[model samples]
Target: MIDFKEKVSETLSLRTGAEVTIEWRINIKGVMTGWCRLREAALILPAAEAVAGLEGRLSMITAYLSDSAKQKGVREIAFHFDLDGTTLTLGIELPLEGARIPSLTPLFRNADWHEREFMELYDIQVIGHPAPRRLFLDRSIDPAAFERLIPYSTFSNGANSKALWEKVMARSGNNRKELQ
Candidate 1:
């Protein structure tokens, strides 16, 4: 069997300009696990016993990231995959001004809700999604106010919401800090 983890690392390092890292982790069951990262892209390879076909393997990683977003309260997700088993999953904790959601619909049909939820909650625009219409937000509410409420309500009250909003707006220039 191919050592997919090593192949993935070598492939990404050769193809992309970004520096990449690889790590092996164990789940509660103590099984061998592997994942790789290039900049914001994350690639997860299943345990040897659980490995499957190419499409199935990629689907598993995307599903894992989706569940992770739900657990982490991430409002947006930008994910894509290339030929060499390199997958990118961008978890947006909160939306920032001018944030553009990457289009995964072209790559995976299942990415529809993941992108829609990101748009509805974080107000991040998903470029080239087939159905870009609003998903969860009430159409009646103003778009600006809708964006305000999604992240704001996580705080205790209006004051805390305003403070958080100001912080988000202020850090728009830097991608590293905007999600914080």
Candidate 2:
């Protein structure tokens, strides 16, 4: 019931000296959701602080490359926060070559997991993270596994077996044309 969209917008602008906008939507169930995109990547720190001041908890983080973004040569990372059952997402765009963002573990402990996941999967650098170690990925796997369009079989060699995916497809009665 705080209607944090305004407070967050004001806090971000006051702290970073940049105007921030948040779009809010209320579903039929009365749940509120907000989205905002920061002008600069460094502004996320102050933005996160504003949410933390409001007793918001970091819920999840996601990073990805969309077709349009890929054409633009940039990747995007979105940070989600849970504030009294309301959800707010703050997103930033990063260059594809050097995607780096500050770690939010200090303000939100659970951010450690989400940060690590994005680091390995998307080749993002969570600068200042306490322990920037691998969580799900093994050392053998290359970083930024999702950055390119590689075949699933090529990516998961140890997954099933040689041609196992094809075999499974055959067993499932699906053809390559149907899959394509």
Candidate 3:
């Protein structure tokens, strides 16, 4: 099997109309893994298109806010794809507030679940999602409760309460009265 290194770069460059950079490493077991940090968040759609053109499969999507990223006022999302058994991860950076990214569900049907999970976990806006709604969370819980409401150490502590909602609303810059 051929490595997707060059093909992926060429395809992404063509689709994004920019020099797409990708780093690849092969494990001792001969499985290849690739990484590409998109220059801008808006470029993700084009990059996804490029990967789809290469017959890649969307394997996973991960959104994170590291302490450094929070300090820098940004969050990050990584899209992992399987290109003929090789792994390629594309990283995108977005603003901490009002972060929005176009939906990849149109290209990868599996993206719907992960996109919804992002909304439930981080308050990310998945624009143009075919169907957008709460997956498992209730309307009372903060959209970004994992980050804003509960401490990471006690994420599953079942701390959902009226007072917690008020605190989250205040921290989110929304009036606590809104929860009334």
| Poorly placed runs, candidate 3 (over 4 Å) | 1-3, 151-180
Q: lDDT score, residue 76, model 2?
A: 93
For residues 131-175, what per-residue lDDT tens digits would candidate 2 score against the true structure?
988777766678888875756765675477656667668667786
Considering summed lDDT, which 10 consecutive residues are worst modelled in model 1? Answer: 41-50
* Candidate 2: segments with Cα more than 4 A from true spot: 1-3, 149-159, 162-180
* Pairs with steric clashes in candidate 1: none
Q: Write the per-residue lDDT of candidate 3 for residues 66-117, one digit (tens) a residue.
A: 9999899999999999988989999999999999999999899999999998
Error of 1 at 14 (Å): 4.1
lDDT of each: 0.45, 0.83, 0.86
TM-score of every candidate relative to the true structure: 0.49, 0.82, 0.81
lDDT of 1 at 73: 51
lDDT of 3 at 45: 94
RMSD to truth, every model: 13.9, 7.4, 6.8
What are the per-residue Cα lDDT tens digits for candidate 1 across 6-65?
Answer: 665555455444444556555676544444433432221121111222332234222122
